[model samples]
Target chain A: MAHHVRTDYGDSDPLFPSKAAVFWYAVLIAGLIAAPYLLESYYLSQLVFIMIYAIVGVALNILSGQAGQVSIGHAAFLAIGAYFTAVAQKYGLPLVLYLPLAGVFTGIAGYLVGLPALRLHGIYLAIATLAFAFIVEEIIARWESVTNGNEGLMLPPPSLFGLKLGTEGFYYLCLLVTVLVVLAAINIIRSSTGRSFMALRDSETAARSMGIDTARYKTTAFALSAGITGIAGALYAHKMSFISPEMFSLSVSIDFVMIIIIGGLVSLRGAVFGAIFMIMADPLLIILKDQLPLWADMVTHGLYLPDSVNQAVQAGVSRVVNAPGLKSLIFGIIIIVFIIYEPLGLDGRWQRVKAYFKQFPLARQRSARPPRMFLKSERR
Target chain B: MLDFTQQLISGVALGCVYGLIALGFVLIYKATEVVNFAQGEIMMLGAFMSVTFITTLGLNYWLSFLLCVIAMAILGAIMERLVLRPILGYPQFSIVMATIGLGLVIRALVGIIWGTDDLRIETPFTDGVFKIGALVIAWDALSIIVATILLCAALYAFFRFTRVGIAMQATSQNMLAAYYMGIPVKRMFSLIWSLSAMVACAAGILLAPITLIHANLGFLGIKAFPAAVLGGFGSIPGAVAGGITIGIVESLSGFYLPEGFKDVAAYVVLLAVLLWKPQGLFGLNAVKKV
Candidate 1:
């Protein structure tokens, strides 16, 4: 019925409703609501993880997408937030009261960090932030009394309104928080503060010349981004029921960057796309792994593979397939291809496609400049 | 007092390793104005390569060390041509993001090959501790410092005396003018990468024994990054000075300060220094043209 109804659909006919787009969103919302009810506890937990990651994606977008601040050490802020929450919980502060407080502390750290970073632009700032990240991890590892060092301290399930928020309950919590966050972010980006950030992003010197306080705003941008990221971190710690330095590594930081790039860097829609892309990519890759043939079998059992790689590949394929590194190698190749060719990323490509469809009925895309003959009589 | 001297000697020796890595970063920045963050990963590879050749393939340590430098130089050169050249003259952010991608790819490659093994190499130098009344210093420490001085001297001569080296310097000074003089700017760019990679390899080969070689040895990349900033991003001499300062400061702090203060003390120094002197000790303040 849908295929028949959508046979003549194109961008030119705005009056004609696209059932596919409508149905996709409708199905997404329905599935999201029903996920906990339908799936087992394990799958529900994964979804909760995805939601937390989405929050991270949103926070990072505030810095990179909106403010042109390239931070690769955001995971440190997460660690700060998580540890703060843990400490708060351990010290008998109510979980709900302490979570937002953790974000405030993280924001303060971000602002302080940003102050130094602002003095040194771009690459220099990145190096400083990277140092901050390493230093944070080292402290977390060394401070046994507080962080319990590498062994990690555990947190009981967060209780909100006298009901313990288990994984299924956390899903609802994450869901509610995610909606509020998404709406808040949308509003913020539409507000004056967001515009100032975008302006600063596009051109700092020009923005300043036009009377924008680039310094104050840059720090504020960090505060806003870090504060949100901190909140997500606090939430994430409770969601996992455990926290460790290994969970927040340089690799995870890169994961956020990769997500932003694949989805879109400069678009709001990109955040959604990025979060979905990252969350879905792992399982999709796993499924793809299960579908491979000859070469896969040999590589899976290659004698050269170390214990970890062997175990991971064996687990992912289960029935004997390709090496774990092979999947990563494929992912690497794709990133290489994207960085080389479509540096603007998938969103940019999507815009061009939409433009092409918009011009289809006319058989030519309209432009201000006309044919060669018309150019000669421009003055007349 | 004896422990203090030993700590100082050990810090300086370890710092020489950071200095060498810092030298690589400065070289890359000098030539192309791009910092190769994957430098630590490259250092990691160099150490792993030396390990693989010496331990696995029955090669002498000295021979493997020399070959690793040459191999890293080639890798660096290839990286410039392949990954970096394509993104030439883009915005700093784009170039940065691209290099990070390159770094990830390189890390993954290293992991695939080595499989995250913590490795060890037989110390090529004699293990002896020298004592002067109250002060004690390991032979490796003194040797590493001496070796660094000799290496720095050789590099100095290369840049000062050789044609390509002078061309590289000129290119670093002003790419357009160098091109005008028929310098072949592209060659200089690749030459910078090759030189930086060699420097990183040398650092890795020297420091592998002391640090206990591992894939995570790359973490020092970030640590040494502060050395670059501290020395001033564009100054070669600054790299050495910054590294030694950090090393001594780190060691002394760990001893003097209460538990956990030493870890962040380096960054605190970095922040303080950056706040006080944004151009760094050796770095020239960038003149903003209005």
Candidate 2:
């Protein structure tokens, strides 16, 4: 569509040839390397979580944004990875070997799920994936012998070469893996397979006409997506130091979806920004909940309001602000709002902001280009 | 033999409840091509509203049910006009995500208003049980079966005789053709949504007596999804048949098999159906034109 237009120089290239782009990368890498030492343990842990989510989001971007397949049951792959890692560790496998094993196993499972997905269309694929997630949860809960049922399984801290990896060590491990995943994702998107995926996503008929084996590419995309998500899951399990089927519920799957959408529809940069936004949103909501009442009091000062009216206002504000569901309610509302207003998500908005600066002298009332419609078939 | 018959009766009753919900799924999918993920939440809201009307407001059960159905219709209409109408031409995923967002909003709203308590509504036939030969059935289950038959007949007659109903049928088949023939297609969407919401409410009211009227009850919508898919995604009759089949299978498996087989049995049946006949038992297989 219109949004996919290449206005910037070297827009289609995988490598950043511009000095400015390389400089930004250097700054970002240096910041990441110094983050653990500069930030507190809690903030470092949050960064680790963001990195994990970014890895999964990038993988999902490959399948959904590039490949045109959507999955609402991605948490299943995460669950599989977590459980397989836990079980494999118990069987005396080292952390190094079991983690990759979890990825491979999850990839195989993803391939199998993709087989049925091959025949299914949009809504049907969504339903099947949803069902697959539920079935996986059921198995985890009931197969007590293997999954330890609803009681959940406790995981030991991972060790490499007989040295126990604590929170700081784990953060490094996660960061390293995330960087590798990002590199792989960039390379994959530049490959022929990635082109086939984009073609299928844009138009199945056109992709088929071009002699692309749509079925094989679709399944392969799923396998790769699940494999990366599985790696994230394994890292997540080690990071949390505790695991349960409850951890990978449907909401978790929905959270991954919000990541890609909020980050940006089809851009890798969008995935990173989306993950960072998703992780930071929780504390942001809490901060708002706490500050809204103070702000309300400040706004309504100097009025000798009746006690009953004051009480009512205060109680109502507190209820609205403090409800547990408010976080999710706001998230749900944001998803709808973004889909309607900003289909390009945070990345799209950022691009507009950059364009504004570039065209500052001649900027008009309707300066930013109208967002391209997300649907390819409906594109003008 | 007695146990088998008892399970069969109960399964039929549960199947009827599922069928009621499945009818709503089929209706929305037929008209909009978007599966309203918030359907279960809609059903749950109906039950909660009926409970408030009956207990908190001190109204008769029938009156409370009627008021709840009307409220649900309005809610459905409002949802369509406000949330769904804006992104009409977008891909199916957009609509589906919007409905999911709606479901989240509805669920949280219900939790805030009603509290998460497991409140039970008292129905007229709460303690009644009928014994016929070697089989015994609860009055709640029996009423559900009766309600299903009556509702199905009413829907059948509505489609066959009513002008709006016929227009809805035509709209589902081909929206452009119906518009050319002078049907108000957009209004038909609101009507279809209201009708679907009303059907979901009926299912909720029927089920409230048998289960706890809590926030988690919206999960039944997910269970009923397999039923709709089993019969065929598009066909009304298929949804009913699929619902009944899933209900019986779940009932029997829960009793005869291991502790948790009941939960996954519906999905297993669904996978089998998808593998063998993806269109469902009654759905027409669509041919792709390239």
Candidate 3:
């Protein structure tokens, strides 16, 4: 095995890290671009959703992961963006105009919400965001004349530059936007702005002492995060073609938080990984539901149990599988298990695996273990 | 004036339920600094358990209530030991997420076992109504208020007079000092969970008659957040006061404000309160030291 050892500072300064990394990035992007041809419409649509959710996950990572601000209500931003597009479509606005406007409107909403966040910290801020989400949902429902109330709004097929986008075109569009957003995120993370956000996360008092404008940066984080999420929401609305207040409820907000946490906090790759996991998990579960009974029967065939007992067992399993809340139940369990066992998330696990391979025979068992965390008193 | 008084009584009764739920939140937060987002789910479970004891098993109402409370207390203790104990030292965000997960799990399990249909529990006071002047109040609402008052009194007595309660208080005040003083701090945590769970069960049973028992009943816990926060996160009395204030505001808004404002009244007040006084009405401000 050969290592690309950096002899000069400039060798390690580029975004790709090494020639091999650049090659891998090229291959990944090529594969993604070729996906529409390789997969059916159903799978292609799923990929579009994965890309869209990845945008939200990346945006949330900027706030919660880099800035250490917990938001249990990011779905509010998504709702605002989606509604912006929906309402804009009603007024006969073009995709080019409404799409960016969606982000701008949602960014303003984020700025308004972030105002109270200056005085609030930790759980208080979380609660404030929660309240804000509820208020937004209520406003959407009650302000029926504009939002269509509970009836929801219908979106026309999206087009760009007077050209109608088919399913494949939409996928490519999402791919293009996702690539741009990821690149922008990378630049932000490497820049002074990202460094200041990280400083604020580590400690506000320290960041303030270091002359970082904590308030301005905090609001900046909220606006930037909300704006990115808004863009994703605009795409999402066009994809779904219809939107309702019920679609952007509290659970959606929780899902965004789950994405970043389960993907791995503080790592950009984690956001993409988390989005993939979240988007794919639904189809995976459905597949499991279909195959589970056969698998159960095969394993139990050797037992030769009574027909009645076997039927009862199969019925029980089917009932559990068919339960409406099973998906959320499994998601809840996964979150708990991850929080307890793998707080660093899927990205952390990947990093450890990479490190273990890099060290090979030299790797110690304890080397990959996370540091023990002590109980930090919330009391001042 | 008549309609206003009627709404006020109903609000107070609804607020008492919120207070009891908020009490559960405050108890767990005070002892462990973990916000149990599943408190409402626990209350839902309590309601379902009572329904099983009363309607399914044909037990007397009072007997079933006692049994439900005891069962929920054990469940709470077990929950703390199993899920919360291992993650004690993690950041507050992880714990909050875990509790939210717990809530989702509980809701699902209840859906699996009981099915998702709404359930009704018959109480002795379900049909009775009290007529005073031009106002008519249902016995269900009145009983909720009375039960809440009694429960609060009992809890006050327990904390003020009992050795275990004092120990729990000590643990909440300063966990390290309490451990140094030979108090079984871990046990105190388990006890606090059980105590809060017991209170939650009582609230659930009281509330079931009014709201109807359903899996989504736990979402009421969201409303209780405003109550708990308004009262101050850790203050027992504050939780109740906050709950009542939210309840009154909600009821009044439902009547006086435009449609749909009632649903978000608690949250609106919560945002306002958070903006005005982040420390809460009863919470003492603490400056962080770097």
Candidate 4:
């Protein structure tokens, strides 16, 4: 095996490893930009949703993946952001003013949540956030004076300056925001603050000993994560044109967590991949629901079983497929399977595949496998 | 004052149910160090199981309850073995997520099997109310409180006197140490899961009379978090105390406080408790060693 040698520090330090990488990214961006022209409005809207979810995944990755603070209630922050946008719009605030304000306000909320979080660790922190989420949901429902209570809030079409955004225009807006957010996330991860977060996540005591102000960084991570998620929420509010407390339920929070996990944690690209998967899973499931029963009948038709048995099998398949909870069941199964088998998520899998192709015939099977991890007991 | 007394009684009953569910959480957390987010779902399954045995199978009420508890115990053991055993030493976060997934799966399964409608479990004590001096207490409430006390006492004795119980205690204290001492740490984990599931089933059966049986009943497990945390996550007695306190606070708040406070009372208390004492009421704070 030959190792490629770098001639200078700049060669090794470049953001894009090679000209090919830069070209690929350029092509990817170009494809994204061209997507609206080729795709239907429905798919364009879905792309907007993907970008929004990607923003949230990135936000959560900053807090959870980088900082090692597990939050089971991030939807609360999203709720804050959406409601902020809704209320700000109600006051005739411009998009530019309210979008940043939504992030800032949600960041403030994150800071408040983080104060209590400073003391809590591991599962306790997760539960506190969970409790915080429940409280936020309740407040949204009961404080109808501003939130409009259970009736929910409706918004006028989001406008930039005085111009209202159509599907394509909004897509561009979301695309611009998504690109900025992703770039900002990458920069944060590369910067000293991001390094400190990693240090804190790896070992808070060690980080503290090394003069990293653990408290400040932890809170900062929370604020940054929540702020980005809030931005996503703002876009989400605009995209939907209506907001409700139910929209930001515990399930949505779980979905955000699922994105980072499925997309692969601790990587910006992973967040995007996870967002795509999360967004796509719903329609995929719907398609599967329709096709599964027919396929079941098809397979059983060839078997030449008795008519009664065939009918019974068909009925069972249809019932399971038609069940309202089928989506959750599939999601639940996927989450469990991923945790057990693919803990590194899709990004990890992608890395392995890339490594395999790079190595070609000489690629060792062991090199592609996830490294075995010992159980690190969290008894304390 | 009489009204207050009646509310208190019902609150205690409600708290006992919470305590029982929290006890399931504490038991699993104590032994396996894995917080079973699906414990409430287990309770829901238990309730649904009993409902099926009674309404579908036409079993006697007590007989169905017994069968349901037994079945849930077996299911819990199976779950621990199949799902949890592989990821025993993983990070708390992964385990938490897995359990949350398991919860979704269980709730969804229940929905598929039982349909999404609310279900009623016709218990022997469903109708009667105990009246004393203008105070009315439903028999179901009284049964819940009584059953909880009895269950706690039984659990106390089991932990104190039984060989398996002592082994479980040892294992919880130090798995490696217990293993070296010839305790079957793996079996103990299975047993703890089964025990926790049984407790959850009992709580579910008791709660079904009041809350009705629904796939979403597993959400009550969320409320049990405060109870478990308030008692400190690992302490059994603390779970009960924290649960009772939350229940009473919730009950009283619903009666006196403005609309919407009741729903959030448990969480408010939880946040306050977490802030005031992160170690919880009965929990011993362990200083981390580098």
Rank order (by TM-score, best first): 4, 3, 2, 1
Q: Tell the DockQ for candidate 1.
A: 0.28
Q: Rank the candidates by DockQ, best first.
A: 3, 4, 2, 1
DockQ preference between candidates 2 and 4, better one: 4
lDDT ranking, best first: 3, 4, 2, 1
Report the lDDT tens digits of candidate 3 across residue range A277-344.
Answer: 99999999999999988877876676888888788889988889999999989999998999999999
lDDT-superior candidate, 3 or 4: 3
lDDT of 1 by residue, A276-297 (tens): 7777778887777656643454
What overall lDDT, based on C-alpha atoms, would model 2 receive against the true structure?
0.87
Separate DockQ for every predicted complex: 0.28, 0.46, 0.80, 0.74
* C-alpha lDDT of candidate 3 relative to the true structure: 0.92
Shift of residue B130 alpha carbon in model 2, Å: 1.9
Backbone clash pairs for candidate 4 read A144-A149, B231-B238
User: Worst lDDT window (10 residues) for model 1 chain B?
Assistant: B90-99
Model 4 lDDT tens row, A251-351: 99999999998998858889999999999998999899889988988888888888998999988998899898998999999899988888889999888
**Weakest 10 consecutive residues, lDDT, candidate 2 chain A?**
A371-380
lDDT of 1 by residue, B35-75 (tens): 78878878888988898888899898778888899999999
TM-score of each: 0.85, 0.95, 0.97, 0.98
Please provide, for model 2 over B1-290, each residue's C-alpha lDDT reduced to its tens digit, 9 standing for 90 to 100: 89988898888888888888889999988877778888999999999998899889999999988999999999899988888877776767767888888888888888878878898898887989998876778999999999988889999998889999999999888777788999998899999999999999999999999988998888888888889998787888888888999999999999999888898898888887887888788888785555
Instruction: Specify the highest-lDDT model's number.
Output: 3
* Per-prediction CA RMSD (Å): 7.5, 2.9, 1.6, 1.4
Estimate the overall C-alpha local distance difference test score of candidate 4.
0.91
